[model samples]
Target: METGWRRVSARKSASRFRRSTSRSMEESTSSAWRVTHRLSSRDSRLRFLAADDSGSSSV
Candidate 1:
């Protein structure tokens, strides 16, 4: 019963996240790039490229 309840809660949150992302891929994509830029400033170009790839794939 405890495990079942945990699964249900996790599913709910996962669906909520999926809904938010899928509903506005453009918004998420922009936000993603923004963060990537901020991170890439302190990180590597490879990470930036990885982020861009993921963003495009999601779209």
Candidate 2:
């Protein structure tokens, strides 16, 4: 009877650990995406500004 109870508790802990790991994985992925998007937009803005400056100087 004690062995059966221990088995059940072990399974419960394993499932909980798996759930937390997946949740963390999802959060990290989303944060990474946000950072990438921000960087890309900033890069595009910088390129645009550079182009504008060059065009004005040429004119």
Lowest lDDT sum, 10 consecutive residues, model 2, at 28-37
lDDT of 2 by residue, 26-51 (tens): 99999999999999999999999999
In TM-score terms, candidate 1 sits at 0.41
Model 1 / residue 31 / CA error / Å: 11
lDDT per model vs. reference: 0.91, 0.99
The lDDT of model 1 is: 0.91
Supply the TM-score for candidate 2: 0.61
Instruction: Kindly report which residue pairs in candidate 1 clash with one another.
Output: none
> Model 1, range 1-59, lDDT digits (tens) per residue?
99999999999999999998887998878899999888878687777888999999999
Alpha carbon lDDT at 22, candidate 1: 84
lDDT of 1 at 41: 82
Which stretches in model 2 have alpha-carbon errors above 4 Å?
A: 1-15
Error of 1 at 2 (Å): 0.7
What TM-score does each of the candidates earn?
0.41, 0.61
